[model samples]
Target: MQADSDPVTSGMIRRLLRLVLGSKGYDLPFKSDTDRNFLLLLVALMSFLAVLACAGTLTLHAMTQRWSSGLENKITIEVKAETPNGEILSPESVKLDTEKIAGMLEGNLAIKSYQVMNEVEIKKLVSPWIGEDFSFDEIPMPGLIAVELSAATPETLETLTQKVLSVAPSARIETHREWLQDILRFVKTLQGLAFLVAMIVVVTTITAISSGVRSRMAIYRNQVEILHLIGAPDPYIARQFQWHAVIVSLLGSVIGTAAGLAVATLIFHLSGKDETALIPEIGLNYGQIAAFIILPLLACLISGTTARFTVLRTLSQMP
Candidate 1:
C-alpha cells in the first residue's frame, strides 16, 4: 500500500499516461505558428506513402508465395512449330510429337500426370494474341504439354531434360521451378527496396518533427526562458510539445490512412483480375487490416517522442 501510495510512483504513472494518451493543454503558444497546418500536411503525405510501401511489400510477398507453391512441381514441354532446320511441321507431325512426349512421361515414374492440349485448347491459349474470331485451321502453333511431377528434384530435371531432348530434339523444357526461383529472388529484392523506402519515410517524419519542435521552441523562446527562471524542469516543458505533436500526428494519420486505403482499393479494382486468372489478387485480410491500424499509432508514438526529445535537448541549452 505504501509503494502504491508513493508520490513519486503516482507522479511517474501520471506523466507516463499523459505522455502516451496526451491531454488538452499547451504551455507554449503553438497557435501562433502560422505554418503548423503545413507541417500536418507534410506528415500526412509521408504517412500515406509509408502505408503504401508497407502494403506493397506485404502484397508482393503473398503473390510470390502463391506463385512458388502453385508452380514448384509443374513443368511445361514446348514442342516447336518448326524443325531445327526452320521448316514448319504439319499438324500430323505435331500430334505425333505430343504422343511421343506423352509416352515418355508415362514411362517416367516421377511424372504424376501429363496433359497434351487439344487443338481447341491450343487455339484458345493463343486467342489473346490472334483473336478468338480467327478461324484459320492450318496455322502452325507450338504444342505445349502440361506436366506435373511427384517431386521436382534436380535429378528429375536432368533426367527429364535428357529424355525430352532424345525424343523431341527441337522441343524446349521449361521447368517452372527454375523461373519461379528467379521471380522469388526478384521479389525479395523488391521487398528489401520497399523496406528501405519505409525506413526513409520514418526518418523523414522524425526529421520533420524535430525541425518543427526547434521552430516552436524558437517561437516560444521568451516564455521558455521565463519558465526556466521560475524553476520549471525540462520534462515539465516537454509535455507541452509532446501533447501537441500527438494531436497533430493522430489527425494527420487518420487522413493519410484513409487516402492510402482508397488508393489501394482503386488500384485493385482497376487491375481487372478475377478468380479464374492465375494472377494473385491484391487485398488485405483481417490480420493485415488490423496490422495496418498500428501504422497510425506508430506515427503518433514517433511524433510524440521526437517532439519530447527535441524540446528537452533544445531547452537544456537555454541560459
Candidate 2:
C-alpha cells in the first residue's frame, strides 16, 4: 500500500484536502499583504458609516411614529387679538374670551381635557425667540389653549371649531394631522437618503474588492498560468482569492462594527441625559442590535463573492 501510494500524488491529495477544508494552502509569494490591509481599512470605515446610517434611520422612524401617535388626538386653539366685531380685543377681553372658550370645551363631549395657557406659560414659549426681557404688555400675543380629545373626527372637530368661533370668533382651531403628515414625509425622505448612501457604500465596497482581486491576479499571473497548465481548476484558484477576501473583510467589518456600536452607545447615553437633544433616547432595540451584529457577516459574503467573480472573469479573458 505504501509503494502504490506515490508521494507526489499523496502530496497533491493533501493540498486538495486542505483547500476543501478552507485552508489557505495556495497563497502566492507576492507582497499583497499591504493591499489587503488597505482593503480591510476601507471596508471597515464603510461598514462603520453604514451601521450609523441604518441606526439613525431606524431611530428617526421610531421617533416619528411616537410623535405622530402622541399628537394625533390633540389640537391647538389660538385666541387671536381681534374679536368677532373686527376690533382689537383688550387683554381683559382676550382673557374673558379664553375663559368662555374653556367653558364651551368643558361642556363638549368630544373634548377630553383643555387648558388655557396662562400669560407666564405663553411668555416662556416665546422666550426662546423673543428675549425674556421683552414686555408682552407692549405687544399682542395670541392666547393659546391646548385641547385633548377623547375621539377626534371630522364632525367632532367641525362642531368644536364652530363653538370656539362663536365664543371667540378670531380663534383658530389647528389639528396636528397636517403637521404630522409633513413630518412623516420629511422622515421618509431622510430614510430614502440614508438607503441611497448605504447602496453607494455597498457598491463602493464591491468595486474595491474587485479591483484588489484583479491586481493580485495580475501579480500572480505566471503562477496561475502554470497551475492552469498543470490541470488546476478555475474554482480552486478562485477559492484562494475568495477566502482571502472573506478573511480580510470579516476582520475589518468586525472592527468597524465594534467601533460603530461604541459610538452609538455613547450617543445613546449622552442623548438620554439631555431631554432636549434632537435625537433623544437614540438607541437600537434588540432586533436592530441583531441586524447590526450581522453587518460583518454580510460584508464578508459580499467581498468573497466579488473576489471570486472578479478572479473568474479575469481568468476567463486570459489567453
Candidate 3:
C-alpha cells in the first residue's frame, strides 16, 4: 500500500508546488544557455550534411533505375554506305540495304518492333555535331534503324545480328549492355561513398556529445561530489545530462532537416520547369520520406546514449 500510494503523493506535491510557483520548476544545471545553443548549432550542421548525403544517394539510385529501364531490350542497327566489292555504295543502294535489313528484322520472332529512320531523321541526329545548316545530300550518311526486342538474350541478339549481316553485309549492331553495366557500377560506388560519409558524420556527432559531457562533468565536479555524498546513484545523475543532450540534438536536427528539405524542394521546383534538364525529379517515395523523417529522432538517440555512457564512465573513475 505504501509503494502504491507513493507515486500519487509525489504527484500531488508536484501539482501543489506548480500552483504556488507558477512557471518555476526544478531542472539540472548541467549546461548553460550558451553551451546548449552551441551544441544545437553543431548538431544542426551535422544533420544538414547527413540529409544531403541521403537525398543524393536516393536521387542517384532513381536515376540509375530510370536509365537502365529506358535502355533495356533496345538495340540500334546502322547500315553503312559500303559494298562487299570494296566500292562506295550510292544513297539509293544504302536505302535499299536499309529496307532489306528492316524487312528481315520485321520477320524475326525476337524483334518486337523495328523502324527505319528517314533521311530527315538521320540528318537531325547528326545536326548537333555538324552544323544544323549542313546539307546531307553532299555527304553520304549511313541509315539508322532502331529495333526493340521482346526477349533480350545473347542467343537472340547473335541470331538477329547474323540475319542482318546476311541481308546487308555493311550493317553494324550496337547494344547498350556494356554501357549500362558501367553506369550501374558507378552508381553503386557513389551510394557506398554516401553511406560512408553519413556514418562518419554520426561518429563525429557522438564524439562531440561525449566531449561536451566530459567538460560539463569537470565544471560541476564539486556539485557532483556533494550529490554522491548525499547517496545519489550514478544512473540518476546521468539521466540529467542525457536528457539535456537529447533535447539539444533533437532541436538542432529538426531545424537542419527542415532547412535541407526546403532546399531540395526549391531545386525540384526549378528542375521541373525545364523538361530537358538532366537532373532527376526530386520526389521521394513514402519509404524514403519516412526514413528522412526518422533521422532527427535517431540523432537524439545517439546523443542521449553517448551522454549516458560518458557520464557513467566518468563517475566510475571517481574515487
Candidate 4:
C-alpha cells in the first residue's frame, strides 16, 4: 500500500491522479489523481503492438499483389529449328519463328504485350551456356517470346499455344500454371501467418493492460478502505480506478504505435536493395498508410474502454 504522507510519494501520486482524471473535473471526496507513469507506459505498448500488426498485414497484402501481378496472364514460347546435322538449329530460323509468333499473338485481344527475342539477343542468352566462341549463326539457338495476356482464361492460353505451334512447327509454348499455383499458395500462407501473429499480440497486450491495472489498484487498498468507511459510493471509487486504467492504457498505445510505425518505415526504406531480387512490396499503400495514422488512436480507445469496464466490474463487490 502507498504511504499516506511521504512528501515525495504523496506529491507524485497526487500529480498522477490529477493528470488522469484532470484537476477539478470530478468532485470525488477521495484522491482523484492520474498515474502518469502507467498511462505513458501503456500508450507506448499499445502503439507498438498496433503498428506491428498493421505493418505485417499491409506487407502481406502487398506481397500477394506483387506475386499475382508477375504471374497474371503471362507465358513464354521457345522456338527451335533442326539444322542439316539434325542436332542443332539455325539462329535466323529461331528469330524468324519468334517474329511470326509475335505477329500471331498481336491479332488476339487477350495478348497485351509480346516481346520477340532476336538472333543477337538469343546469342547473348546462350553465351552463358555455349561460351563466346560458340557461333549461334551455324547452330540454332532456341528463340523465346515472352507474352503477357490481358485477363485471359487458362483455356484461351491453351488455344493460343496450339495455334502458335501449328503455324511455327518448331515453337513450343510453356504454360506457367504450376509455378503460378506455387506462388499463390506461398502468398496465402504468409498472409495467414501474419494474421495469426497479429491476433496473438492483441491478446497478449490486453492481458498485460488488465494485469497492470490490477497491480496498481492493489496499492490503493488503504485509500479504498478509507473511502469505504466514509460511505463513498462504489461508482465514485470505481470511476477513479477506471480513469487511471484508461490513462495508463492510452500511454501504452501511444508508445506501441510509435515503435511499430518506426519499424515499418525502416523496412520500407531498406527494400531498395538489388534490382533483380524478388523484394516484397514493403511500402505502404494509400489505404494502409492512412490506417497506420489512425491505428494508435483506435488502440487507445479500445484499451481505455476495455479497462474502464474491467475496473468497474472488479469494484462492483466493494461495500
What TM-score, over all chains together, does every model reach? 0.82, 0.82, 0.85, 0.76
lDDT of 1: 0.80
- How far does residue 33 in candidate 1 sit from its true spot (Å)? 4.1
Model 4 stretches with alpha carbons more than 4 Å out = 1-22, 25-46, 80-87, 119-140, 228-233, 285-287
lDDT of 4: 0.67
What is the overall TM-score of model 2 with all chains considered together? 0.82
Steric collisions counted per model: 0, 0, 0, 28
Candidate 2 residue 22 C-alpha distance from true site, Å: 4.4
TM-score of 1: 0.82
Model 2 agreement with the true structure over 1-319: per-residue lDDT tens digits: 1222433433443354356545544445422246866887898998998888788788888888788778888999998887567777788788888888988878677889888998899998888788798776787788899999998889989988888988887889989788679878999999999899889989999999999899888878998898877887888788878877776687789889889878987887778898755544667888888888789999989998999999899889866
Q: Give per-residue CA lDDT, model 3, range 190-300, as digits (tens).
A: 999999999999999999999988988888888888877788899877876777777678778988888877676566577778875655565666688678878899998
Instruction: Return the top candidate by TM-score.
Output: 3
The candidate that achieves the highest lDDT relative to the unseen native structure: 2
- Worst 10-residue lDDT window for candidate 2 reads 1-10
Runs of candidate 3 exceeding 4 Å displacement: 1-27, 31-33, 83-87, 278-282, 285-287
lDDT of each: 0.80, 0.81, 0.79, 0.67
Question: How close to the true structure is residue 86 of candidate 2, measured as C-alpha lDDT?
Answer: 70
Higher-TM-score candidate of 1 and 3: 3
As for model 2, its CA RMSD to the true structure in angstroms is 6.6
